[model samples]
Target: MAQRLQSISAVTVSGALVIVLLLTLTFGTLGAVAFRADSLSGLSTRDWAAVRFTVVQAFLSALLSVILAIPVARALARRQFWGRSVLVTLLGAPFILPVIVAVLGLLSVFGRNGLLSQALGFAGLEPVSIYGAHGVVLAHVFFNLPLATRLILQGWLAIPAERFRLAASLGFGARDILRHLEWPMLLAVVPGAFMVIFLICTTSFAVALALGGGPKATTIELAIYQAFRFDFNLSKAALLALAQFGLCAIAAVISLWVSIPAGQGAGLDRVVARRDGSRILDFTVLLLVTLFLITPLGVIAVKGLGSVLSLPASTYGAAGRSVCVALASALLTIALTLPLALLAQRVSKLIEGVGYLSIAASPLVIGTGLFILVYRWADPVVLALPITILVNAAMSLPFALRAIAPALAEVERDYGRLSDSLGLTGMARMRLVILPRLRRPLGFGAGLAAALSMGDLGVIALFADPDSATLPLAMYRLMTAYRMDDAHGAALLLLSLSLLLFWVFDRGGRVNADI
Candidate 1:
């Protein structure tokens, strides 16, 4: 019975994988159909400019983020001080943070009437503008720096304690440590990190639209938005979507190729206790990096406190809609991800790769393709909320898989044979053994999915009508309309909800949980 059940499970999972593949292929087909004879000929001087600007800014953003993360990661790795754990937790906040909220926070610190401009004026220096390419890069760096630091810090933690002890005994100095211990890890980690950030920035829309200043800083994503939303040119949008798809696919392939395993192991609790790094240098790096990261969030909190209550009834309506979408997306993401992750334990690499297809495919491309595909058969605007939910869920699947796959594998490995011997098969085994054992990862994955869905602005921007605007879109409208007070209040509310959702689910998973 157990053998039969296992066979049935495998077959079911494989069929699910095929459905996912077919769904992805449909995007390509629809995109191809949407392309017109003059789609390529439709490319204007401004379109080419957008293409150039997109690649340039993404490369610069990735480069600066990785280069600066090294010292910060090293500093955190070597130093054990008060609030280190809190700081490490804070490092993860930016990854799941709402892009629009982060933009507002950044504007509070770097905008024309911001603190930095005022300080520069007082010091008799020219007040700088946070617009154009520089502003886009700054925002990208703010979002990605913490991600890079966490990745590299994991690399540092993965280094064996024995190696550090031996180096210390051999009288290895900081330079020696750098040459032997740190450099190799950076070589392994930096490329992957750079490629990931580059891919992320390539598809950025809100940051570019808000801070790109004008067409001078427009990215391919912004171009796609313009073609679809402003010009209502489906063929041109399809062509631009194809271009963005190619860019992301190439970056994703390179990222996967150069990616190190992030050194996941059991010895992280055993600290290396390095004797090489300079105390003064580590302190300075830690201080500056912390301030750079925390200041924007602080600005949001301070600015939003007074304005929160003054937000309009429409803002609350948008918030309610956003929460519903987030909840539905989170549930759907886990439903799709869990089965695939379970199958991944025994499936081929190709099957696993299919699960990650959404990562390499631009959200705008997916939205555009789906819009074209659905428009032929139904009213696209009426289905806008549902489509947004589906796209957000798909976008969050990769993260959900990352969170749950390992735990699923471990559970099956540790208990599979035991369950079989005990005549535990199918649902009985899952309820009594699997669910209990997998709660932490399941909770964490669900939390990440929920938070991510709540903050997403990409796909919905393409599909949503004015009446269906999610909170992020609504907040964006407020900003564009120059309602700074309402925008800041909405930003605060969104920020709080995202963090709260993450905390609730993540903490729920850890509570009374068996390691």
Candidate 2:
């Protein structure tokens, strides 16, 4: 028995070390660099303006997304029609869409000569420019609306059918329903949804970089990049990183606090015997929301079909590099998650929170810390790809753990005693028992990680030179150069890769999966 336990000591210790090292780098290194500059005392008017803009835009974006989502989500929740599932799936598309690609799609529909502007121009109105604060908020809403909708939708779906049936029995009308059941759910759900979207917006860089021009609209994430890349002002960059991290930390606390679960009693999954309010109103909301979300992507697809195949060699090169990064990041996600999950089973589960640290520290903030550390030893430019790969993996770790850990716990619960009784342990148990059962979740998680890495435009933008550029960065370069066609082509290619990798990895080898 002693020998059996000792067999995995080294591996266990290694997992602990990994968590320690992650914590040290995440906060410890940043803490040291943050105080190195008088940046805390030296924040300029522009710096404070960036901070203000960051919070204000994020607040507005979150508020608007939630407000718009309420009607849309309620409609979807009560009405189950043909193609409803497909529509729900489409809502998730923006999340995985590359930031730069989504920005292009938004531009296609809302740019100065875009569909909206063109329509207005044909009606003898002015062409509206999407290159400022309005554009930034518009882009943030486009990306986050679905997220807010889905979050609220889940809240709606959580209401047991029995409750609605009882409400109908009591002769509750729309307003009555709003007061009794709907308001309670909204009270419980909306704060968390708003905070999540706000956190995401506060950390937005690509949207701001592409649309938010001028000092008045700069976000802390973008300011970090400008200070780091253009000004070569490490002090300013570190300070901005500090600010962004603090912002995220406060938002995280609020999300956790405000996200208290109101008890919705369990049900028999029966259908509700209640009327969905105003079919015309609900249908109109669905139609407009669908078109609003889908039209821009459709424009990108139609435009890119003409050029995706004949894109420049550099486009394909960047695509290949992104693929490599995605694959590497996925692999690393697996490596990190499996060990940490096992350590949790054997030790304490609180350690798993280390995986989530990446979320609170935006990729740029992490890159900023890494830069501070690397600058002391080696040129960060030389280490760009590696750093991007590492950050992508770390960022994906939380999602991977969410996928893998639960399955692992269940597997261990069902099989742990048997494996031990049979003298199965370590690699043998993993190969013969654990890995087989985890195939589905592993596939899904790795696919998600790969998809995210493929579409990522955050950390790489902070670190990469032309030679080290990922596809998203390359597309941004094209957009900046006014090569719209090439940019769309690259966007198409990137969009394809992101979706394909996710589909392949998610569906890969799940044929008769053990679970």
Candidate 3:
């Protein structure tokens, strides 16, 4: 009876936290709406244009990312070589890589003075510019392609070796193998990957701000930033935020509907000898994909080596602020995620839908709303850092839940009854039976939250006073000032800090951890 009461208490606490998050979002959005009730007149022509451009770019980015990922994922799945595991791990890098860093790296490879343009100029050919709509698409593809590839690769890996063996026993050639086995898997996986990437691209702020050369290429997110930061038009910002919220929510709903879990069940590690895919073709694909992903990162490292130590003192100050925010966010996220995950083991469907609300939310909307709420009571700038930390933690909850929930459920499934029978309730049970087994996922989730928070530039950009800029925002300011070298240095610092935080947390979790 005591153990049951403890379980109920856990569930109740988790449910209350979820309710608080939902209420915060709901009331904040509604409050912004009320504040702008008169200004909620129809969207201007420019607003419509922003909406149109946003959807089109997200669609194009998602389509191109998934289509390109297919070949790369297939090649990786079939080819066995030295450093395969390393390559797979490298794919996760883009997830935590700061957007500004990626944009700079990409510019080094595709900008007017870049290698491609220089080679073309040497050959008496016209230099190509990487700006406008195509530039935005290129950046999105760079970031999302690896994500799509990993998702598709997970699908491929999930296919049982026994199935492959059966197909081979029937003398299935390359064409037959693709037609019979691979096509079906793609059918199940691609749409979900496309939708997920599309939703992500919809909320893109940093990439669009940098690569989108002008109004012609501007995304809705950039428009929101302009409304809030440059124009100081809270009404217009709120309106745009609502529009963005609607767009992402619709996409999120569709994604939830069409999404088949890609990497769910385990597969045998045995390699199935397959009579498919040309060795030459696989090698070419692998080489191009590797170059595409690796060159920009290499440029960042090489270019920053000369100037990384010469960054302005303000850069280090911003880095310190960012570290504090990231650490706080990570700790908060883990605290929120643990109970939510534990509760999710009992009410998965409901908890999952609620968790996705964060993804559908616009950071600008939340910031605008909070600014309205707190400005009435106190100066918004005073609460800026705390609000940023809370918002970052909220933004990270879904991912943290994804990392931790499954492990919690698995533990409960495997060991719940044993603990209950032993009368192990409350803190003792958690420390003795639950936490020791949860180290790996907890560590990974915390690391991910920290890295993401460290690099995030959304809410903070709206709230930060001059003295309160975070690292990413500091880098943006340097770029805007045309201090390219300083910007590179800041990027290097931000990148190193983000990766180091992730490595330390992840390694900590894995030490003496059970698989």
lDDT of each: 0.84, 0.88, 0.84
Q: Please give, for residues 108-129, the per-residue lDDT of candidate 1 as tens digits.
A: 8899878899999999988788
Q: How many backbone collisions does model 3 have?
A: 0
Compared with the true structure, what per-residue lDDT tens digits does model 3 show for residues 1-515? 96779767977687677757756865566566556734546567887788899999999999999999999999898888899889888888999888888888888789887778899999999888787899899999999999999999988987887778888889888789888788888988999999999999998888888878466888888888888889987778778877888899899999879887644245577778555779889879878989999998888888888898988898999999999999999998888888777666766647755665788886767787887677778987788889888888888888988888878888989999999898887778779888899999889988999999999988888888879999999998988898888887888898999999999888999999965
Q: Write the per-residue lDDT of candidate 2 for residues 1-515, one digit (tens) a residue.
A: 76477647845886787797678667865786586556487778899999999999999999999999999999998887899999999999898888898899989998986899999998999988888888999999999999999999999999999988888888888899888899999999999999999999998889999999688889898888898889988898888888898999999889878996857879888877457489889989999999998998999999999989989898899999999999999998888888888888777788777877877878888888887787878988889888888888888888889998899899989999998999987778889999999999899889989999998888888778898899999999999999999989999999999999999988984867956
Q: Clashes in model 2: which pairs?
A: none
lDDT of 1 at 497: 93
Ranking under TM-score, best-scoring first?
2, 3, 1
What lDDT, from 0 to 1, does candidate 1 have? Answer: 0.84
Better of 1 and 3 by lDDT: 3
| lDDT ranking from best candidate downward | 2, 3, 1
Candidate 3: C-alpha RMSD to true structure equals 2.3
Give the Cα-based TM-score of candidate 3 against the true structure.
Answer: 0.95
Error of 1 at 246 (Å): 0.4
The regions of model 2 sitting more than 4 angstroms off are: 7-11
What candidate 1 gets wrong by more than 4 Å, as runs, is: 6-18, 25-39, 260-269
